[model samples]
Target: MGNLDKDILEKIDDWLSSSYDEETRASVQKLIDDQAETELIDSFYKDLEFGTGGLRGIMGVGSNRMNKYTIGKATQGLSNYLIKQFPNQEIKVAVSYDSRNNSQSFGQLVAQVFAANGIKVYLFNELRPTPMLSFAIRHFGCKSGVMLTASHNPKEYNGYKAYWNDGSQLTAPHDKNVIDEVNAIASVKDIRFEGNTQNIIPVGEEIDPIYIEANKALSIHPEAVQAQKDLKIVYSPIHGTGITIVPKMLASWGFENVTVVTEQATPDGNFPTVIYPNPEEEDAMALAKKKGEEIDADLVLATDPDADRVGIAVKNSQGQFQLLNGNQIGSLLIYYVLSAKSDLKQLGNNPYIVKTIVTSNLQADIANHYHVAHYETLTGFKYIGELMTKLGDSAQYLAGGEESYGYLVGDLVRDKDAPNSCAFLAEMTAYFKSKGKTVYEVLLDIYQEFGCYQEKLISLTKKGKAGAEEIQAMMAGLRQNLPTTLGGIEVKEIRDYELSQTTDMKTGRKSEITLPKSDVLQFITVDGDVISARPSGTEPKIKFYCSVKGTLHDKSDYLSLQNTLEEKVDRMMKDIVG
Candidate 1:
């Protein structure tokens, strides 16, 4: 065997000869007997690191992969932490999963492990979305929660997302604390694999209606929905868990002319229609787009596999259906909410909003126009959730979103929710229609009013050990030598999140940024361009976000202005890396 193969085999041998269960041993032995060299190697490469997002990897038999044992170990660690953290309190955890191949099984394993540790477990009877799991954690007043999902990743992948009592993913000391607990586990023998049947409660049917009713009350422009009840909309779930509640959420919202994409409607773990199964990908929304074209629908919407994020399509000025990036959707939602509720007498003047640093600044610009305070957090929605918890009682949060199609309307749930976003996006369509406008027209007007804000994201995937080392080197190089300029504009400010320092180029003054330490670098150009570089904590990739903005004189300049901004983004990318 090759050196790499020998290393993998040694890891597998350790698991086989160690204290693993009979079934796990038998599975590994079967791979050995069948001479499945590639499978064995892939499975034993390394243990899956429990990052802030939780555990995620291809489902298989390995110490590092996503399987019953891995899930159990993670739950055991989390359980230990919960017991220690809340010694005097009753420890309860909510568990839910998506429509992936082994999602339900993994979720059950988690519940069983938690229950074995004397913690109460509220488990979903069937596959559910991730957002509900976030909501359930807070709704049930649980200490922590777990969701079995990989978000928009392909079928081969599965994951676990851990949440604290605030309904947000762990941050700062908590994230590190959980990781330490998980690593302290020496072997499978450390896990409490035995489960208590009594503590495991099936919670789907009881919770579904409660979630729908709560969401319905969050609508700000119900009058528009009442007026335009027959608003034409096309939706697709891309063969995931969205079908479970999206249509139901819309029906509850009083949308009557909704058309479901039949071929892509069902809940299938394999995701037969698209290779990526991410709504952000055009190919994944093919059926939805086709249906929109055939019916001449007003708008099209699609959700990722786990239903945490959503993508949209609207009729552009040329009468052609075009996909709206995350920034566009985020901006439109904020605009609709602010403009509609500005006249609401009951609404308070202390209304606040949120978006990630990577999200388009158009949101901040819009909020400024309405005199609302918009906060910027780290890339993850969990940070947005953290802000909500920190500012509880002190400030009223209106909404928050990121550039990856994830959004949260109201504080009902502490995570990015597609069901809520779907309902609101449809309502926004109706609200615009009531003013003799389409959703597309509202977008154009927003651009005209707030300057045409353009943003682009580029991700570079570097796989395996060598890739990891290369990415580290790239980050180190950037930190050591800051770029002087980008897109022909002087770099005025540099924020290194890892160091929590922001340096002004003109005065050479450094100030502390009050946020958790993260490995991110952002540069603000002299001409109002914002460029941020970040490496994914969960995936083996690095992402660069370029944002540029300019005033639009009229509707005729929209396309040309868009193209000019695209060119500026290209030049910025080359300057930063080349």
Candidate 2:
């Protein structure tokens, strides 16, 4: 305790004296007696902030951790904000949890807090996908919702995603206001722990069918699905929530030959199969890939713990299984949706699609080809959902996705829906199979039409408080000393999202960037290469996204051109990030 900071010691003392539970106090005392300086500092250095998305952190007995007390405080604050926002009206909220270690308990605590505060609660009986939680918000006419899952984070971490009435995460004023409310609670005693059993309701059986039916309705080619019903598809949930609904949705979509990777079929918080349950990682999909190889499957799909994002593997030109990046998958999904809508004459006026700023520009080109308007938002899926709500009736939302293996079709749910994406992916595979082609073949065809766009994301992880400062300093250094040239190409323009301005390097003319202010910088080169530098909002890392475009006159030139682009990206990353 002598080595600990004076302020941190005081905070620990407060926790010991406060109305915290006996277990929490004992844990705090043990840390103090054991002189666990690092753990003490990390756990109580600062309060776990309720950011725009909500709280996420390692689970422990600390103010900065995800625990019963922290969860209760967040819920009570949300309860207060809801009552203020919806005065006199009956306030309703839905709660759902993933297969994380204490996600179910935290979710129940959140529901109890809402119920204790006189707000009606509709809680899922078991683990469900995060998108279904979003769907339940609208399905049950609830004013808000909470999803308990760390979403692709490691086993030690957990999170809470707060949703609004429109089935989207909180944005703008609500996000800030909720943060304010959460910060106002001074002590644990301020939280209401007792739940009103009458106000708390169990909701799964009735909501599941409606949600599955909604996803099933998004299918465009029922005939193609019937014709290619035996399309061999391998799927794994990676011991997450996807197992609850993915197979059921696929089967309902007429996929008769779906094979589940039984080893990873059960939902487990420990994620026993992989290092990270994220579908984006190749190692996480190894089991599913093995299953696919055994069955000679047409496609392999895997979803993260919350089932909000999906990663896919398909046979390449050499007949070897290759994992398609998020951009490739998003481009294919949008392309399929747009082309099918056009073929069916469903391209109504004001047809639009959405993608994040870091996503591939190929989506914009595809939207242009089909004459559909495309919008780019900030990095989070909530921003896409916010755009959907803002465009309520004036524009038709065909589909939207990000470069993080998340896609949504027909705007049924405001958040990313992996189960829905899986269904549509299989359907798209079936449709292509009817044409004697594979999804990979369709992707190559797309590149052949629109210039091949290659994108790479390099993330540098920096852990602990010092790492956070290092990340900030890195961003600051780049901002202060802007790069004039990258990979021997002249930097044509610089878009400083934090400053909300774009400066032309040659002309020195400045123009305002109309997007919301964020800590991101983009360098546009004369050769049409775009390099974006932004720190991850949810993780302890900074990411550099590089995209290069080149003409693919012939399919044979694909590999050579891809190699050239990759070399260029490596050079650019070294020049800028180093």
| Best-matching candidate per TM-score | 2
Tens digits of per-residue lDDT for model 2, 138-254:
988999999999999989999999999999999988999999999999988899999898999998667777988988887899999999999999999999999999999999999
Global lDDT for candidate 2?
0.93
lDDT of 1 by residue, 397-511 (tens): 8887999999988889889999999999999999888899988888889999989988988888786566778889888999998998887889999999999999999999999
Worst 10 residues of 1 by lDDT: 1-10
**lDDT per model, in order?**
0.88, 0.93
- Regions of model 1 farther than 4 Å from truth: 5-10, 26-42
Deviation of model 2 at 372, angstroms:
0.3
TM-scores of all candidate predictions against the true structure: 0.96, 0.99
Among these predicted structures, which one has the highest lDDT?
2
Deviation of model 2 at 127, angstroms:
0.5
